[model samples]
Target: MNATCEPRSPRAVRISSSPAELAGLGTLLKCVQAGVGDVPALLALAKDVGDTAPRPGAGRTALLWEILASVTAVDVAAGRILEPHLDAAAILAQAGGAAAADFASDRVSDRVPDSVPFEGAWGVFAAEAPGLTLEAGDAAGRTVLNGSKPWCSIAAQLDHAVLTARLAGGGRAAFAVNLHAAGVSFADPKWTSLGLREVPSGTVHFEAVPAIPLGGAGWYYQRPGFAWGGIGVAACWLGGAVAVARSYQGALQKAADGGREPDQLALAHLGEIDRTLAALIQYFARTAARIDAGELSGPGAWSEALRVRGGAAAAVERIQTLVSQNLGPGPLAFDPRYAKRMADLSLYIRQHHGMRDDAQLGALTFKGGHPW
Candidate 1:
């Protein structure tokens, strides 16, 4: 149990009225503002919040999205790292068992830090690559993980991870494992990307690593919370897009301050971005409301999540284009923060799956009788 990875009680903080500040993010905003922006700090914040970030379909889903968006707006990389930790919490809660109970109880008590089951920083490593597969099987009457998992973002830094592994019966089962345990080793972080460089993601190999099975075979993806978690990622994308839009606005303001009047083309682009983002926000709110009302669950959740993610991803691309074309090469070439945001967002949104996801949504819509 590393002292730095221990979750602590959240402190009270003040908010500022700066024009750039996203005051509407509410309590979550204060948490982000008070913390030092780093992996350990983000993990501490995740554990401190514990089951507080309104689980999708449990109600207050809009507020949950706002919190995710606000974090990304402050820093896209932080948003990338935090969203999954929050999602992992939601999944554990939904999976309800001894581990989940222990996690819930440990958060409020003075128990030994990081010694409890399912405490500290956590990640969900479900991504699979070609020729790479993790398997779970019995060994000495206990289930253990073997093989490797890919795209495990900042895995070496986390204390625990909830991942999926193929069972002997030809299906996948979810399991939670301590990353610090023996037989858990990470590959050399060969990440060379400009975006999310702070979060080096790579492969982790397991040699009979002991684990706690989360749910029965196929339960991880079959649960409604899975779709809800996908929607949460879209929320992060929306937040990143908002930050880019703000950068463009800031550039425009600077130009005006220098006695240059706003041009029609730039204003038109801004108007278009505003319109697109406003509509996307409405869509997210509507989806969240439906999810809470039990209207978007089961099979329906899949398509609704796809729609939200697709729309959010498209909105991000459009915002990026508008900002880049108008601002030219100055921001990417000179402004470090701006450049980092651009690079981070460009890579982050790739998680959306683009047209492939669109195709899945199309199939789902046809199967659902075309609710248009």
Candidate 2:
């Protein structure tokens, strides 16, 4: 795999002083030592790290800043696969009340068992199909749900899922369902993509399955934490791109061993990749600092999160094009880890709603009040 190009000038890395930084550095060190090898293996490892609460009861953004630090240090699908449950748990904890107790049970970071996945993609597709629906059960604190939930990752592997369903009375609501419940079943994996085959996503059918509502209707996306989670996704993409840059390093080493000079054009492309990734990382740091300080709130949080996601997606796409060109076939064809990272990232970043998100951000931009 390619390595990140070494800087010509020697510079010492700064030591992290804040709790978020310390957590990130510690996680990053662990990942660097073990590193993220297999995509599925990382998720399994996360599941096995039982009872690990991320700074227990810490604010949503603070927890995300720390966890996501390691995510980028590793790779894409590894982070994306594990993020939802952690994000859900933290968000639930911050929301407090019965919702907190529900997720805080064995389902979340409590014992980590295969962890859990938040399945809400259907909410985005509600206009086109029949999404899952929820009905109040005869028993108090219980409800029955039926219909299909799509874009479910690691469907059979996860023991529980947090899904959004249409309430019988009409508005949308989030429900936490135990996958092993009687009426729940996982369909054959329908994902055929080259990237992220490890975390296959498909339709999950629920038939009168019992569920616990998470917050009230519209409570799911109407919080600052939603945008915080988006920033976490961007962090994953940044990590994947970093892995790709590492592959380029291997290419440089190969050339040196062959007594060949580094190609100017390749170096130029590498320069761009380095600059782009550096800027993204710095941006995350600034935002994370704001998050930790409780400064990232109000109407601006989501828009700011949108900008970070858009910028990271754009950087990753640029890196993909540049890396493929500069290194040619060797890395893509021969380097297994690099190849997997690139492929996984390619699919993982699609989680960012392409032109639609860009358009939304543009509209926000045109309104002209957003800070530069």
Candidate 3:
């Protein structure tokens, strides 16, 4: 062994907020709005978070999530429940790993309601490939992916996708493929029962076509950013909750001024939703801090993150129930926007991995094996 490898004390790494990060995020959001999906812009955004290094702490995932969140915030500000846009933001945040936890919290306050959509998949296909039999291959030195990906939010609008596929060697890989590439196609854009109708989500098909590799094969799951994707999904749900509460409050104010009795149930529901958002923000903040400090390493840290995500999913379900009940048949009248908002929230929150049976099983396995 090299003498230089003698046991060394771990150096303390401080987790400080970066104004530059915030500014960069703002600039990137503007570019996204301007249709600047050029490679130069993407690379520049990557560099802002130190994405080119051997191990770029949070990597591209964190950047993607922040970008998504900012765009969703823009939509929320415009009073439109753009659930697909919000889902995109969540997916990007979870791409890199737990490193996005801080990025998510710090930037949530700055989000604006912009109508731009992200051009990448939310990593659902890639993350689920190992167990789902999703497949990819190379044809004539150009990467090709073939599979059916359900619930690709913004599929119709996106120009490209960072798609994931399995290798012949029983491993996984990812590639960036243009949606307009030869042999690539999408199913008819049908509106779901839920409120977010603009997403244009549908199935996508791929025959052998050209694709640019993302990270190395098998690197998608093993990367830290993949786990953090849940946090992004959680943040989007929380944002939806915020939108619902705002709508309820506005309705309550109108009823009060009109000499109508306040909807006591709606008020109570708003309180519960508020409480959940507060707790989630605090939990995510602490988790981010711990991960930054390197204290949240190993299986235990991942388990805790999963628990947070599951809890967020449950809170969202409760909020949706309460909102629908309080709004009553008024939302269904087609005049009030409450119904649409509720529909958007319902569809968006259901996108999380925790909503699946296997996700629950995975969480149980981690918790049972280690209490840390």
Best candidate according to TM-score: 1
Which window of ten consecutive residues has the lowest lDDT sum in model 2?
119-128
lDDT of 1 by residue, 68-141 (tens): 78778767887888888888888887887665665445552333222336578889999999999999988867
lDDT of 2 by residue, 1-372 (tens): 343342222111221235544443454335433535564456555553323535221443444444554454455565666676565555655566565464446655433233234432111111113554334342334467777777777767766666777766667767666787678788886677988767787777877776666778777677677777778777667766776776676567767887876878888988998888778877876777777677776667788899899988999899989888776676667666667778888888887887899888888888883887
Q: How accurate is candidate 1 locally (lDDT)?
A: 0.79
In candidate 1, clashing pairs total 0
Q: Mark the 10 consecutive residues where model 1 has the least summed lDDT.
A: 1-10
Query: 55-101 in candidate 3: lDDT tens per residue?
Result: 21233333333343443332322112222233323334434423233
Superposed Cα deviation of residue 303, candidate 1 (Å):
0.5
Count the clashes in each prediction.
0, 9, 19
Candidate 3 has what TM-score? 0.64
Clashing pairs in 1: none
Please give the CA lDDT of all the candidate structures: 0.79, 0.63, 0.49
Q: How far does residue 113 in candidate 3 sit from its true spot (Å)?
A: 37
